[model samples]
Target: MSGKTISELTNEELLDKRKKAKNANIISAVLIGFFVGIAVFSAIKKGLGFFTFFPLIFVFMLMRNQSEAKELDKEIKSRNLHF
Candidate 1:
């Protein structure tokens, strides 16, 4: 568990959290893509081009991923290490 209240973790711990978050993002994308593909294909079979859920979901997830990375970057840089 990362008992780091977002303001107490060191650079290495922040980096590790970023890595885990990124991995989770990748997994989410893969699973969502699979399910979305199935849904889109089923819709297409019915002559319907009125579907845009997957893209929206992907963008949302990607944004969350980037946000997490940025937060970690900000926290790590705020330390002002001088070694």
Candidate 2:
């Protein structure tokens, strides 16, 4: 990540940052799926516990990442740039 904000980044930097964000979002999604699977399995075997609730945090992060991606898309569009 750069010190500059999204609005301040040059087109190249913006594109790079968007790529990183997409990768991060993909990773987050994978983790969320994994955590949800663990939560479900844990719940079935041990009843409600820490594992069951752990996925919530990842879900929140995933949502935030998605929002960030949307913001990046908006910025790109505002600049009349295509991806």
Candidate 3:
């Protein structure tokens, strides 16, 4: 994702990146849910503000991670790389 594309990465590096991507996806999903709950609570208590838009950032990150993971999976499959 830095200077290297998925196809440019070595098998070990690809696996490592894939693992990190998956972990980030999980964390992002949890954060999005948490922020959403907070946003709902804040909305009920007061009115819409920063909290309302905060979860959207996490949603974007989750989507980005999913995309990266899918790309990595495709590369891995094309290369026949396995755990």
Candidate 4:
């Protein structure tokens, strides 16, 4: 997060950042799906109390990463970098 601004970054740097953000988004989505499955399974098997907290935490982390990726995508788009 503490890096160059959009205007300061070279086109190659922007493309690299965009690619990394895209990969992070994909990985986070897949992890979120996996955690959601675990959460559902736990909820169905139990009464949905303390046991669901672990999966819920993971889901939150994945969601945060997804949001960060989205922000990066917006930055890239705002700079008109296609990658």
Residue pairs with backbone overlap in model 2:
none
TM-score of 1: 0.54
Clashes of each: 0, 0, 0, 0
Between candidates 2 and 4, name the one with more favorable TM-score.
Answer: 2
| Regions of model 1 farther than 4 Å from truth | 1-3, 46-67, 77-83
- Stretches of candidate 3 exceeding 4 Å from the true structure: 47-50
RMSD of 3: 2.5
Cα lDDT of model 1 by residue, 1-83, tens digit: 45656677766666677678778778877867776776677577754444545455665665565666566667767776322
TM-score of each: 0.54, 0.82, 0.72, 0.79
lDDT of 3 by residue, 10-34 (tens): 8999999988987887887788788
Off by over 4 Å in 2: none
**Alpha-carbon error at 48 in model 2, in Å?**
1.2
